[model samples]
Target: MLKNKSWWSQTIQCHMQNQKSLYIFVSVLFMMGVIFGAIIVNTLDLNQKNGLINYLGYFFRQLKENSIAEPSIAFQHAVGDYLKTVGLIWILGLSVIGIPVILILIFIKGLVIGFTVGFLVNQLSWDGLWFACVSVAPQNLLAVPALIIVSVAGISFSLLLVRNRLIQHRGTIYPQFISFSFLATGMGLLLIIAAGIEAYASPWMMKEMIPQVSWITVPNGS
Candidate 1:
């Protein structure tokens, strides 16, 4: 156990030493995407805003009616989605050209999150803030870090490939590829946990809170 701990510590230290800049860059890029997404909420015209609001209202009604998918089904779907995203990132890490695409994927992930939270807070005020905390924040608390780590890892591996092709032509890439695959697998596991929280915990919390919110109308029969 101690040896494993030490190995992990050394690995992390090495990663930080070599890839700290990439981590900062990826994190900043994601935050920029998030800010841009929030700004987009402000740019929507009245009609557009109203349309989104109506959709949200409908969703909330469904939520209040407990018409949402069963937790098991939701968990399956969420796990599938998370797996696909992680698998894509892992694949992207194998190709040099995929670096930019990996970055874009991370940005889009952040943008979607920011937009969801921003729209909720803008429309619902305190209630929206509460709802976002309960629903959005839970899964993302695990997911965002997992994504950022995997994104950085993907970019780093792609860069390594470039270096191997251009600077050092004699080395085998199998070892590095194995390490990258392991990292991706670990992050994927973390995302699965996040999916579980999203599927089970968030819905339960949202359901409990829905009745207290003044804005979401309980549908006629519900």
Candidate 2:
């Protein structure tokens, strides 16, 4: 067991060492997307802000009334969404031209997250902060890292293909492809755990927190 564990650890260390720059670039890009998303919230017109606020208020009322989907259904939907993203990234890694698209997807993921959290905090103040802590942070703790790792792996593989094509290098890509596939599989497992937290634990926490946040007023007749 120790031998296998050591081998796995060494393999991961080697990959990280080799792909250090790619990791940094992908991470920075995702953070830039997140910051841009937050800025977008600040740029919203009064009418747009009011529209979103009204929609959010209605959703909160549904949440407070216990009208949300069942945990099983939520779990299924979350798993499907997570897996689709993973699958797309894995497929993209196989194509040299897909690198840009992969990067865009990672950025979009970060943007969505930033927007959701930004909106919550912008409108709810401290309550939004607390609510976001419970609702957004939990699953994202796993999901974000999984996504970033997969994004790096995908970009690295695509770059390898690009380099080989440009230089006419005759090295076999089979071994690296295997490693990349394994990494995606591992990330998929991690995302499943994140999905479980999102579908079950997050909602439970949100329900527990809704009443405690004094400013989340439910609409009349809700």
Candidate 3:
């Protein structure tokens, strides 16, 4: 009983540490990017019930219909296309940079996410939010964390590289390697989540009476 209690305590501690670290990374992005940048972006006063929003609505509607009517190659291609964008971001962040560079990367990421969510809200009225809750939110929960991990490591490494703080021997590489490994693992997990949603949940949501749920498996028949 004592051993079991110790094990459970250790697990909780590790989980809390992980959560704290993740929160720090994500909070940095939000503080520097959206809160700072939005004042300018919103000056344009983009909002719901616009012509652009209407077009996006139509496009998403067509997407839903197509997904239900035909599960074709094009459908698979769409998932590939989105994942490619995510891969590009990871690659860029891996190159790393100083505070300015990191901020720029973070800002760019925020813009993409902000536009995506805002566009949906604009286009579909209230339903856009529901659609996003189903489609974007789940995968993003994983993907954003992975992105933050990658970006933080990249920025750290890049700063070290720029300062020529390279270790004289290979032994020092272990710590850096370990850090990158964790971040890469996070990225892989997020990609898996995204793929699962694309292959399984998204299609099923359209065809069957289901919302985009987590790890929901629909059998072949009935």
Candidate 4:
């Protein structure tokens, strides 16, 4: 007679298998995406940078001018960004709308990236483009995958609530928590990378690679 493993061992085995697959797949994809982003950013032009800088400068000037009257622009911007990020994280981790929220967040992320990349290419030519890229790209590569994994966990939880098909326990939450932990690990990795890039790579690029950008104003007295 063949011996059968217990339920707990089977579950642990499945989890281990899933984890190994994810580790291999996620790592390769993240690295490739980061490499491609760097290459693309390396080729942006200067006229575009100046044009974007001029427009955004005008926008910021308007923002500052309005701030003098309201003084809430800064607060509003900060609060909005924080609430969206934090609130969605919570919702996805526990709420029924987690997957859709993830989709929405992903869409927003893509758009922000598109706009930011366009702005950089237009403003900095090649150097500013690359500088902004290395500064941002390193962290984003890790964080994006984490967000998606969290979304999947939320989705799994919601599914169990609706139907106890694959999930054997409705009350237990270890699986969801485990997935969220993976997401957190990705985010933590991103933090380490972001901090290093901000402190070291940014300064080095600013000092050595940044173009000596300047504007001339000559006084006439003849």
**Per-prediction TM-score to the true structure, in the order listed:** 0.91, 0.92, 0.58, 0.50
Q: lDDT per prediction?
A: 0.87, 0.88, 0.53, 0.49
Going through the candidates in order, what is the number of backbone clashes in each? 0, 0, 0, 6
Q: Scored by Cα lDDT, where does model 3 land?
A: 0.53
Candidate 2: worst-modelled 10 consecutive residues by lDDT: 213-222
Residue 141 deviation, candidate 4, in Å? 2.7
The best-first sequence of candidates by lDDT reads 2, 1, 3, 4
Residue 101's lDDT in candidate 1: 95
Q: Model 2: what TM-score?
A: 0.92
Off by over 4 Å in 4: 1-52, 55-87, 123-125, 165-171, 178-196, 199-207, 212-222
Identify the leading candidate in terms of lDDT: 2
Across 1-222, the per-residue lDDT of candidate 3 in tens digits comes to 999668645743553475566447655765556444434434444553354545544444455455433444544664575456445544554453344565566666666666665655543446656665666666667666555655555555455454444543223445655655555555565666666665556655533322322122223222
* lDDT per residue (tens digit) for residues 1-222 in model 1: 999768766876676678899999999999999998998999999999887877777777778778889999999999999999999999999998999999999899889988998999898888898989999999999999888888888898898899998778767888888877877887898999999999999998988777656565433543
Mark the 10 consecutive residues where model 1 has the least summed lDDT: 213-222
**Alpha-carbon shift of residue 79 in model 1 (angstroms):** 0.6
- Candidate 1 achieves a global lDDT of 0.87
Tens-digit per-residue lDDT, 1-222, candidate 4: 123235434644554466565445444544454445445544557776455566644533443343222324433443344335644665665655465665555555544555565455545567546755664465455445544444444455555555543445446666656655554444444444444544444444433433332121211212
